[model samples]
Target: MNPNDLVQFLKKDPKDFTKDDIIRFCEENKIEMVNFRYVAADGRLKTLNFVLSSKEYLDTILSDGERVDGSSLFPFIEAGSSDLYVIPRYSTAFMDPFAEVPTLDILCSFYDNTGKPLASSPEYILRQAAIAFKRETGMDYKCLGELEYYVISDVDEIYPGVDQKGYHESAPYCKFAEMRTQALLMVARAGGKIKYGHSEVGCFTKDGKYYEQHEIEFLPCDPILAVEQLIIAKWVLRMLGSQYGVEVSFAPKITVGKAGSGMHFHMLAEKNGRNVMVKDGKLSDTAKKMIAGILDIGDAITAFGNPIPTSYLRLVPHQEAPTYICWGDRNRSVVVRVPLGWTGSTDMAIEANFGLKRRVEKASKQTFEYRVADGAADVYETVASLIIGAMHGLSMPNALEMADKLYASGNIFDKEYASFLKKLRQLPTSCSESADVLLKNRKLFEKDGIFPPGVIDAQAKKLKAFKDAGLSDKLLGNEKEFAKLVQKYIHIG
Candidate 1:
């Protein structure tokens, strides 16, 4: 049994977890409830609980998962043929931190009536896309999500924080530090490879409602697990909010003029388990191909990356978000940004200590960040689309040329590069436009039959129903209506 782990399991890694091991651990730890959790069509976690009355009952529950109404969970499924099975993955086992009773929670994958992996399931789609990418390019597409959100609460004005000046702000001046720290610990304990957590730059008070933004970033891993980590982190954050008598929102925007939450994804290419995004202190060719692929398909993916009406509002100019489709090194105003990756830098420890020697060679930390995604994104579908886009770029003959032509120096929005910014493409400004682009470019995602046509049609139909062509303009100068709109979507994750 590991003392550091919340679950007293003998296995150090959850990948090595087995059914027998889970049974033994539950019996020994007096776990009363076993919860099977999975992501439904609406991009929220659903759970089916079981009570462990006896060993035989426990074995049966673990061996053969229970049936669920697929029609209720997924909009595409017909009620007549909605029966589906959910089988738990041993690697996702964790103890429910919010449960009053001892409970073991394991994330499940969906299966159809024929016991085949559900083709429309987001999990299955992402898995197939990854396998196809690896088979085609002999390299892996690793990604990490930068999940940002605001913790809304009703508090007194004793300790107030300034608006848009809360970057890395500490306690007394900044609130919700305890909530963020607990979320970070729970995420790490639940198999999320967390990088760090901190206060963000969008803190303010409006009508007795306080909004403080915070972000929890994860280390790079396989795309499938990366999305799972984000989903789990969101679940934990919401659970904590409920317990703390506050509100947690992953909404893209809470008001008209402030920083909005963006779920940016940093991606890197790896071949033979070695980073290939940088070599000789310069961007590698493989990395450029990935950037080109994202640029080519950025607009179309907005259907999954920015699904809500308010998502377009967040992409407006002067908010530090991207409006044009372009790529640049460490530029925040472009859709695709190559962040500072510690390239050509010496060891910091050696520089700080006079007598210390360099012990190991520097590893590449270069990543291509897709800045178009927001909190309303369908995590699984969005990542699957990005992976397919990368594969497309790798296969394209003129991918490198495309990347070179779209590169901008410094901020693309700067007056110096105004001419170049105009030449670049523009991202969709409304959900209607995104739906149109997605339908037009459907062939890009359907090339290898990874994304089902039905799925694409459903998303397009949903986005078109919003009818928010000029929602931002209409809401301008109407603070009452804007506040109502923000409250309506203040809990979207």
Candidate 2:
């Protein structure tokens, strides 16, 4: 059990949090403030603070929730009828590690005046998508995000590190290792099922600023919870960065030639609580359908996964980012990748030590990673699109054929496959192009009214406002211009 988790410490199941329990805990723990946090349309965490005055006030706030102007939070909402309610989700309650006033933070959901979940809310959309996916496919779609960001600090020449060689470095070389480890612990304590945290393959010194890339990956879970965990993880990392007098950026690109951060998501489908992504030492048909489904609407997903202008710059060739829509085993150049896992090996304890007698069998860790998304992505919307696209592919009559045709045996950009790569469809090259593709393929997400029409239009309009068509080519070979663009969006994630 996590010692920092209030729920676990109280010996209560995570799903069993109640208002009375929170009130009692606050009273016993002498908590002074209650923070109601939720995700706004800008994809940032918004907070509503309340100083606990009396038991009656605490009960009322926790039970009935509070109201806020929806128009101000969402661009699609009208001010004339903008009153919306923010109700707390009990399971998301946690102690604010950074709060000095003994505060408790709880994530909230949006509800309309009629007491219905707001259709345009990202949290609601993601929950509905998960429900719909399970109902239609008889399987639960589990997803985990690989969040990558660059931590920037003032350059110190004493222990200066080499450029592009920061992967898994140790103390005295990795400047921010201890701070990142602290963030990992904080996130895990706050209910994020984190897998691990590590330094990545991008380190640079430019203009007396030191930039080092790092990643925090999580374990697979339900789509809604998965996205929530990621959002919280981002918040914790940023909060720690601020306390440490450094800057953390989730932007897709920091330079024109260096390695860029990609928020890659690994996906798996489970049935009866067992992974169904692999079968008989090979990729299963179910997995193929999901891949085919995502590939079918691959361009449309960019509207949510890669929304900003600099996003296209990172999608360029030779950056370990995908330029073409394809899937391959362990291929980083493709949009979808079936990563290597311990699928056929087990009993390592006995093999490593003859003194050991027990043979252990490992659970399946099979999954396919979607490498198209970046840090600028709205976690909820991006996940919802993937689920909707997967459902569409599962229902498609020719999904397997589509997957078969797009499968690549090796690096897609190789000379032998140069002719074949030309025939493969390319992802959107600019923010405007992404908006156009999303508009063209809007029907896929709108089939079950899962994605609100207004939300789609709003996102498209937002992307089009960037007016960044051919922006990558225009900034190519111009390091000064690229640096300006990177600086503008350095803290955008």
Candidate 3:
């Protein structure tokens, strides 16, 4: 099914819908249970479910939310801290297709007893960041996250090394075709608008190996909805895979020396529903400003984008993963790539300027894709940091000019990787390095107290502990240890 056609099923923004609307829908559909999901400090999904039996119970939850132990989720609340409230965001409600019974999964937020947004809540932080940006610029942004993962029957059944080839290979070569279709179809039914799902470039090459790479690219939506869709899609895939006796992994390095999955985000900024990233067939001032801000904080943002030790294994220089701190027009080697038909502006402008009409078919208006993040990172925190960086750039006078220089710098990841290091910095090679950067630059995120005052402190502490333990050393050097670790954490089984 065309993804655009699935838009009609999407739930309206929570702020736009009334409590009565959701209650009415639940009554009409007879959704027997409600699964409330929220993001932990580490960005993993946690759930508190309820068996719905009456409108009164539903109404109470819709208004007051359910209370849960906050201390259980790391870095969220202390052991003695008062229990936090898990308020369901009605807009995120979608049917759980894999559940034994008809159930609704609604993404939720953490709040204190007085109904204040919890400082430790990633979702709330993401929302505050977006609202802060909109308040300052009077413009809103929409985003989409492209997710890639490996589908295999067992964790050990992975395709490794240069011999494996699976990018868009048809049928027998892409043995997981049926799984891909059902996963994408499940995403759509769960209210996500995925543009397309296809076999990816990395897979297990061994004849008997049952491993394949798959990608699901979503259409642009607001920050809250976009992140929700990613989490929902992942949750659904995990559940569906279990029924089929398959293993699904979004781990950065499922296997050493091969392509790792990435969760690239696409974004578009608009003011009064008009594209603000492009104007009159040129890169709008807003677009340049945002890009400049992103570049300015590119390396440090990795704490949330590529936070784990395994992530570094995938982001090395030679692989498809981006390591250089630069952006290029459709140059995947760079950290950021403005693809050929990005936002349609460049494609259309080229035709009008050079009479290349035939190539304008996919021309878009004004959209930007941030390719630095990987699937293993925390989505809410990562996107929030991205928004903060972009908005911060808008405040700088030379942001646009600086962006031009970086974009014109060519592929910094070219043959002379060593030479480019003298000018452009490489992405942080470890969780510790990136955490240190965040600690030093804490003020950037704390501006106007938009993010909680101690967010940086808390995050730094977490990363520091992970680093001091020497987890990265063990994961990278010992294959036996790495396989065991991947089986336990990465497989999501």
The local lDDT score (0 to 100) that residue 89 gets in candidate 1 is 88
lDDT of 3 by residue, 1-493 (tens): 4232112433454445567777777787778998888877655678788899799998988898888888887564678876888887766666777778878777788888688888667788888888988998888978889999988754343233234578877675566778778888877876687788888888764335456788989887789878978887887778778878877888887776767888898776788876777766666788878988988888888878887767777777667778777776766767666664454334445677796466434434557778878887789888888888888889999997788767734555556545645777677777788888887777888875666767777777766776634465656668787666655558531
lDDT of 1: 0.89
What is candidate 3's CA lDDT for residue 45? 72
Q: How far is candidate 2 from the true structure (C-alpha RMSD, Å)?
A: 1.4
lDDT for every model? 0.89, 0.90, 0.75
Task: Give the Cα error of residue 224 in candidate 3, in Å.
Answer: 0.7
Q: Which ten residues in a row have the lowest lDDT in candidate 2?
A: 1-10
Higher-TM-score candidate among 2 and 3? 2
Better of 1 and 3 by TM-score: 1
Better of 1 and 2 by lDDT: 2
Would you estimate the TM-scores of all the predictions? 0.97, 0.97, 0.87
Q: What is the per-residue lDDT of model 2 for residues 454-484, given as tens digits with 9 covering 90 to 100? A: 9899999999999999998898789999889
Clashing pairs in 2: none
Clashing pairs in 3: 159-204, 343-364, 343-365, 344-363, 344-364, 345-364
C-alpha lDDT (0 to 100) for residue 139 of candidate 1: 91
